[model samples]
Target: MRVVNIHERVYRAEPDALGALLGTLASRGDRLWPVGAWPKMAFDRPLQVGATGGHGPIGYRVEAYRPGRSVWFAFLRPAGFAGGHGLEIEALGEGRTLLRHRLEMTISGVARLSWPLAFRPLHDALVEDALTRAEIELDLPPTVRRWSPRVRVLRWIVSGGSARPQALAG
Candidate 1:
């Protein structure tokens, strides 16, 4: 088991505002098809996340959900291959929300060991790049203040504390 990729970003907006933006992006199931899911109706179902693209026949389980605050999802790959992805929204100030996305991927079996070492870095880089692109595409404002490396590390330490499944209100 090994980490393949990890990417995160901080948006300079309140959690509600950020959620609104994410809601817009996730509004159309077709729009999210590239990531996963088949039709628009799929996203309508409560907490149902299934694979639709090249990621294989994987599905996501909502691990945690805090309305207008944070959300966590676990990707369940076939044959015991599992990974977790989560978004943490922390209120930094009056009008700023620190959005942190964390990803943990573990590859098992003899055939998968090589993949983690060979593709981990690439996946990490790709995730970071994708987040940057998403920020640009979403037209989010620049972060008012960026957290220090130490602070970020500390935050990561406590990230696991918040993990509970809940229905998302559309």
Candidate 2:
């Protein structure tokens, strides 16, 4: 089955400002990736086509890129997850931007079961935390969270104690 998962947040910053943060998405020391609750998105080099990295179990290589705009990473691991995920900035005007993270893939074989069972919940939380961190950097408030009990439970199951939920400060 081909599944697409998209998560997005609006930030109180221009597209350029928010897009520049991509430089930090794929590096061990990326100051922009939220460290407290999400896996650090890291790559061996700067964000560019062919650059490879991922947040942990999920892995990908940069398939397309636009500086200060968008990036798409084609999955390289968790076999059968054949497609791509990426970050995009949509200029919402009036000094605001919409930051979007999207995952699109055709799940087959073991990945079909693994993605929903092991990845979805934690992935959702991680994306939200990353966006919240971006909002904080832009001097805005974190988005209101909707962590359902099922999500929380899934987090605990996948990440062990590291899935501890934090107070979403506005």
TM-score of each: 0.53, 0.86
Quick one: best lDDT, which candidate?
A: 2
Span of ten consecutive residues with least summed lDDT in model 1: 32-41
Alpha-carbon runs more than 4 Å astray in model 2: 144-146, 160-163, 167-170
Per-residue CA lDDT of model 1 for 15-62, tens digit only, reads 676664444333342221113211121333443244222232435666
Which candidate has the top score in TM-score? 2
What would the TM-score be for candidate 1 when compared with the true structure?
Answer: 0.53
Clashing pairs in 2: 26-42, 26-43, 27-42
The models' CA-based lDDT, in order, is 0.46, 0.79
Candidate 2, lDDT over the whole model: 0.79
lDDT of 1: 0.46
For every model shown, the clashing-pair count is 1, 3
Q: Could you tell me the lDDT of residue 77 within candidate 1?
A: 47
